[model samples]
Target: MRRHGWRWVLIGVLGLLVTGCFAPSGPRFGDGSAVPEEVSRVRLPVRPGPDGTWVVNSPGEGLLGQGRVLVRRAGPDRRGWRLALPAEFALTSQRPGSAHSAFVGDHSVVLVGGREGRRGPSEIAGLDLTNGRLAWRLRVAPDSRVFSYDEGATVLVADCRAGSCRLTGVSYPTGRRVWSRTAPGAVKVLDGCRADAFVADPVVGRAPCHPYLVTRDRVSLLDMADGRLYERPGLRIPPGGIDRITENHGRITLATAPAKGSCRATVVSESGGDGAQDLGWRYTFVWDQPQAPRDPATGCRWDRTLPLTVVRSLVLPDAEGALVLDPYLGLRKQLRRLAPGEYLTADETRVEVVHASGRPDRPLHPTRTPLRPPGLSPAARFLTRLLWQDGRRLVLLDHQNRPLWEAASACRAFMGDGEGPGVSLTYCDGPDLVTVRPAWKD
Candidate 1:
């Protein structure tokens, strides 16, 4: 007994030491008492047509205009360019000269060559940020979308017209085509992982529309480095159907509605194998109704209605298996299990239950209690968007979701640009990077 007690004591001490080293310092909130210092304003150069329709920089070092193509610079001295296609080339609406603009970090002054309503053949041109000189130009089809870039070496372009599509890997400096592959049908670029890009085609069978009309609804993995294509199995979702697919840890996870009209999720390993053989575990939510009530005080409008089925929002960390958030039964639950493989099912799985505070007595309640532990305060939850794991400790954020303060140090905070009407606070943290933004009216 004495020997066992000594061993346990040593283990506990070692655990404490490890925890102390990795423990994150508590969060710090700005006192509501004092008015925040003003941030400086900068007058960005106005483009030709629209006064403010140019581009706005988001919270991070990214530029957001039309789609998810948020471009950022590799470094402060480095500049990145994006060739925007003409509105006629776009499947959607056009935003003036923004039809061709290179997002150089937060500064969106670089204008490439493309007219608002122009169609057919177009040449790509980018304004240099360093010396205000013309960078490079390339001839491209009207319907081409610039997918990615690696400095000046290569740029991937996806040209889609009608129901036919072709992906070309082009050398930027020489305007020479490195390699090109034409799919049989309209292809949608899904996601990029590692050095490969995943695309899916939805039209199969004999269609006499374009050069590649017979090959739709098929998934293919293409090597970005060389434009090599690896065709995967056919995805037979219903017409006009969409699936949420994400790639993490070299594995592809797809959530789709099964033919039986139930939501299902499948995980596929990067290793090539039979398509059906690669299906991972499947889960079905048993709720009679999945949608939350607009007013928690009022119970679901139709208790007698059949339960709606939906896939839970799951976040899988590289090392921590899968974390599924089940916001049902008035409580939030988390499921953690080994990495799911093909043919696995969520049956008899042990899940940790996070109970909400207070019981629902009335038909609806104003404040629905949290399903998770109270360890995360309201501010922490609001700042969850900015919370990312660094090592073991989570990097905390300010109220604005900016990474102003890391939880590593208790006393130090990182403040960003303080010029205009934007709120700015001093930090005991390291030197701040001052960025200018347009003034905002209260």
Candidate 2:
């Protein structure tokens, strides 16, 4: 009897220990704050996928490893899926856009890998999103860089050495070689501008039709299907090395910064001291115009800084102010008098200040009660949504800057439309992939 009683007591103690290990200690929200009932959370180790709808885990070291991938959707039910990548091979997402590393096609999630373990060649793997199966694998040149891909095809720039690069294409799902082309000069691909120019080719389906390749001397468009080169002589390469390129309304703008180590010491008369700092420069070019590119500003501004490229706006930050380009790729205006803790961001509509705390300095849209204390009220009939980055945490805010929801992120990046009703913010939070839908209406 005593032995039986002791065994029962031991089992009860073990049960309590297991429960303590798995039970929720407090709240998932940062700083011990209670997570609101409307907010949702999921825990998985991952990075942001190609789009806001999914997230994929980073690969382990070697040519053959395994990890997990997840796809999430937004709605009342918030249904989604997850799959552990097959252990037969290893793959990783590279050169991601917004928050995506691997390309999520209509049918599969494609990932690229470099030679790591005993593998001799670089390769790409396609995993079926439906059943978590490895559908295809293709060995590519060790130096090749995948520029664009989809369910229809994959395009890349290969053998970029000895002053030239080769454009190559491969068929989808089958991993068959299709076509390749050799270019004359060192090729640099401008990421966002597709050679297809935003139009879907009827033959290529929705795959990235072609990639825009720029060289030391010219800008040329590559044909992804047959490797045809369409050279545009109208696009001239302006003086000062092109550091960044963006396309808007058929016009291409390239921003240039001061040459490396081109700093001149300045005299401080009050203290009889001299100091030197790097300067920044800006340049803009056109697509079909015959004239040379324009240099609108020249001064010792600051160290080299990359242009903040957006869909409709290009902003070059200077020590004095920020130069904003209009929709037509022309100088719109220079924003001045920025506060010390403020950062500038311009969309198609207006210039706004992102405060140091990650919240905007003011409401993005018209506020129904600008002076009222924030928080949802019974009389509130509408709500505006905005995303703020507080360190590694993503905060969802309303028009009045009230935080409706929050989550941590590993990449500190966000994707999807915040202004829309159903669009969700998908990101990775260390070992967890999270998606939060903003309450866009009262």
Candidate 3:
């Protein structure tokens, strides 16, 4: 007994040494009393747009609201334009595949959704982003929903009653019908084209790809120029209902949960808001080859553990922060808790807390050691230079992996169009929408 006790004591001390040497420790700033000088915050008089989709990419534009108001970047005076949405006409929140309800295109901003509850048909209206002038309005099917908008084409999938669905492609500037396709049963759209709507920046490192139409039976690649379907036999949807689908680094991952059991899928309000239901999770099947998806990694989870991508790796939430999982769903690393809850998202350079319905923000950053991609050893996943917010703190980390500036922030949730430092962050503090800008000396 004495010998075994000594051996366990030695193991405990070694574990402490390993963690003490590598755990990321830094100063936690703020008493929530005063705002820092280096951090610039501009408050607009409006509620935040949508819940889970807050992505801002331009410096000139700042806040967008579900009430259909677009407040431009504020000068010192906090004066900005307010384009009021029609009375009782609330904007739609982000749905699966679609990044934002107010899809901001190059030539126009397409707003989808109609009157709050008297739902017969939804309206898709195109407006000038700067002036908020209604260019054209098209009434879609009662079951209409925005799937995605890429380049000048905005795809809407509707008429999903029974088993048949229709896909309509609308032009961004003109609101004219480009093309339409019909498929049997409920259809899922996967971003297969070089589209900037689902990404952080539209210009940098953005490449072209094809769009795919997925059904319960088969997968079809979409032609963005026109509504042509190219069926792909390489990938196939696994048995059971699909829960969530995520794509990163040219690979697709599909999450499926049991439909009829104690662990069946459950819908809960993420922000505790009315009429907004966020589906929460189980098995993950990753597919990269021109063949079917691999065997699923099976696990039953109750708490919301949405698939988040960081450094091109699949990250799932844990108690501390998140877990970087390998292609085979093996634990790689445990990231530090930067925000509240498990709601986090990331892009190439930055990671931010994502919130829905005014929930507490959760922080997501690595703690102990740098994470590398699967099968790669020497190369490391690095957050070289980033400006991100965790609940109430805004941190600007420099190239040397040092905090350039940390300040007490009012940004409970960050509203962004995508990821990265250049992405504009808009959030709601009480009744006012706040946009945060870091006053960097560079």
Candidate 4:
């Protein structure tokens, strides 16, 4: 635990640096010939364009203009730079609280703000990605936090007012509150735990004990759609106490350590239309150093005290953060291809490949199949990149969960497209948005 102390601290520091930028590898081109390099640092509004180009436009008041300002997508492809958006456009946001952002479907972008007392997100706004036109903006709660997005341009937000928080489903380009329900508390959806809309009751204002079981607060799951909420799989609190409840994809997990030093977890799958619990599995591990937690030497042996179905993998720690595993010997098959000492994070259906050096391993070619692609209740499929946009910054980390690089600007707007080596992104330093294509120095 002492040896791994620095890692935990570094993770906290790097969490803020998730969105990162690259210093373009110089003179390189997707084409065979290396010609004069395009200057990436410019005083223009920029965005990543289709086909493999960077869109740049002359400055305007608060948007990109057509007559006074020219827009063009520039790249080495020689496709004759395409005309960029004619309407005004600016990734620079005026809302408060990191400008909660998400892309709608594929043609629109959304930025939301509503952190009480702080710089408030006066409105939740969406824009046409291609034309840079105003799509819609909704007036939201002063303390609203947009968590995830839909395939289209929709968002799920936590609107906390007075004392209770409501999980509201609102559509973009129309700012309509399609569905909403009072949330249990500050329950967060994890990246890999994989629960779509179903959230555990994060009992607030109560003791750290299991309030759902004691108070019998309804255990419910909300559909991420513009639909309804359902109460299903009424769960019970185990003996010891619940360490926490997390969901990724569609998998909902309730964890406790019944024994003194054992880690017991109950995993529940979302019911299929009907109100059945669907499938529930249980796992237990007696970590060698439970106090340390996340210890690589902490061998996982199923308690077998309880029963489980469709056992997937045991999560263990690497030198960096942690990795997922199958119950059998060695590592999980999904991580079989990883070199010795390398690590991987399993969430939803994707496996992130890590190298022994604790850096994200981007193979020359693309990676396809997931060693153990599991089904889920929530979470969308994403690329295998180390960093992504959070508001105006690229939130990225290194293999050891350290900051990859710091941005040179205050960051006004940011966006990441695709996943893995194919992942591309753009961010703003005021109005100067820089595009970063996933690539590495050999």
> Lowest summed lDDT over 10 consecutive residues: which window, candidate 2?
264-273
| Model 3, C-alpha of 227: deviation from truth (Å) | 1.0
Model 2: residue 102 alpha-carbon error in angstroms:
0.9
Query: 141-181 in candidate 3: lDDT tens per residue?
Result: 76555544434465554455556667778776678888886
lDDT of 1: 0.36
Ranking by lDDT: 3, 2, 4, 1
lDDT of each: 0.36, 0.44, 0.46, 0.38
Instruction: Flag regions of model 3 displaced more than 4 Å.
Output: 1-63, 66-68, 74-80, 88-100, 105-107, 118-121, 150-152, 184-211, 248-250, 262-305, 308-310, 315-324, 328-409, 412-442
Best by lDDT: 3
lDDT of 1 by residue, 34-100 (tens): 2222343222121211321224333333232332222332334555444343442231223212244
Residue runs of model 4 more than 4 Å from their true location after superposition: 1-44, 47-100, 114-122, 130-133, 160-164, 179-219, 234-251, 254-279, 284-314, 318-323, 327-442
- Model 4: per-residue lDDT, tens digit, 375-425? 211122222334433333333444444544435324433333233333344
TM-score of each: 0.41, 0.54, 0.54, 0.40
Off by over 4 Å in 2: 1-83, 86-94, 97-100, 115-121, 149-152, 193-210, 263-307, 310-312, 327-329, 332-342, 346-351, 354-442
